[model samples]
Target: MEGTPDEFGAYRLLAGSVVPRPIAWVSTRSPDGVDNLAPYSFFNVVAYDPPVVMFAPVGVGDDLKDSPRNAIETEEFVVNVVTRDLAEAMNETSATLPHGESEFDHAGLDRAESVAVDPPRVAAAKVAFECELYETLEVGTSTMVLGEVVYAHVADETTTDGKLDVEKLDAVGRLSGSLYATTRERFALERPD
Candidate 1:
């Protein structure tokens, strides 16, 4: 762990230590009108005041990923949360299809039109954020795209008195290689103010 590990080694270390990572099922429409859907485990919310989220999509042999490319070209994308029930569909969408291929069709997933963005979202997602491209930072081989969420959708059943219920959400997380986890475990820690 002291030496500068190779790219793959570094990724393995991080991916293993990260434990459970939330999945960002991103949807974007290419300029040619092809709909693309992919899941990025390197994703998280960066800010709340302006409602910003970021996802790092590593290049495929120095080639730009379709998600970042479409976001850059159209300046819009949708982040759909993956529920446990939709795990298979979410995983299916991650297949590396050729450019201009529609993952919505490839994965047999339904597309729901976004309100404020041109890209569509997964019809079954409990939560979806319609975001506008805020900035892109080239972080090594991966490109970090920041998006400013403009419109948000949340299923009524997933909330209790306006607060998210983790049990109701039943989201899945990525764990190392092909492993995945559910949010069924519970623990709590109060922040020391």
Candidate 2:
């Protein structure tokens, strides 16, 4: 906390210290009609009122990754929640494929039509958010994309009386490096009034 940490060191410290982070399984469509899918650990909800979410895409070297580039070009994307069951398939999609190659096909995942966005969503995803590009910011070596949800899809079994049930969601989270966490263990605490 005293001196400035180097780039790689700072990234390692931040990522390692952040504990478990939710993964945004972002899906986007390229201008040439290719579907791109990838998982981003640097993602979270930004605003509840507007249903806004953000995901940061850190490019390799000087090349912008396909997901963010597609979102920027099309101004649309879908955020599919990564559950425990979809963990392996989600990781499969992270492999770097040549431009215009469909990760869905590579991962053997079926695609579902999106209502408000051009990009498709993961058919097996229990929950998905169709979003329109709201803003984008260049932060250091990553590009932060902010999107407003235009439509949402949720599995009926994951809901309790029309509301999402956390236990049923079975979401997975990213830890440091190749480690991951699940929602199997949970504790609720009462907030101060």
Candidate 3:
């Protein structure tokens, strides 16, 4: 179970070991106004004080992917939460289209204008975070993008007393390969004081 940290081996190990990771359905707009959408499994919340989130996107070749490239160039992006109902569309957006191609069109998804960012968000998402590029880190073949959320959108159906209801949200998570996990079966455990 040990070997050199080569590209394929390392990725397979890490991706397989991480039981279930949240998918960041990110959207960005190219400088030329082309809207880009893609899903990144290597994503998570980084901070709460400033409400920051991070997503790591790997390059397709020598060039960067549209999501990261657009965010870097325009300094804005949106993270749309993928739910069970939107899983198929989210997967469609993951396809590597020609640079500047609109994933929204390819997936037949609708876009909604973001409040604090230029990039549009998926209209069907239950929750969306409008972010401004806070920082970027180069780690091997991936570019880690840290974004400070300036605004947020939450669907009324997914909220209870202004807080997100996980059951109602019904979010989906990314597993290894083409697998996905659901939030349908969940249990609560109170934290110790």
Q: Which prediction has the highest lDDT against the true structure?
A: 2
Ordered from best to worst lDDT, the candidate numbers read 2, 3, 1
Best by TM-score: 2
Candidate 3: list runs displaced more than 4 Å. 1-8, 60-62
Clashing pairs in 1: none
Q: Write model 2 residue lDDT over 1-193, tens digit each, in one string.
A: 5666674498888888797999999999999999999999999999988999999988633478989988988999999999999999999999989877899999999999999789999999999999999999888788999999999999999999999999899999998989999999999999999
Ranking of all predicted structures according to TM-score, beginning with the best and ending with the worst: 2, 3, 1
RMSD (Å) per prediction: 1.9, 1.9, 1.9
Compose the digit string of candidate 1's lDDT tens values, residues 59-83.
7334878888999889999999998
Candidates' lDDT values, in order?
A: 0.91, 0.93, 0.92
lDDT of 3: 0.92
lDDT of 2 at 179: 94
Clashes of 3: 0
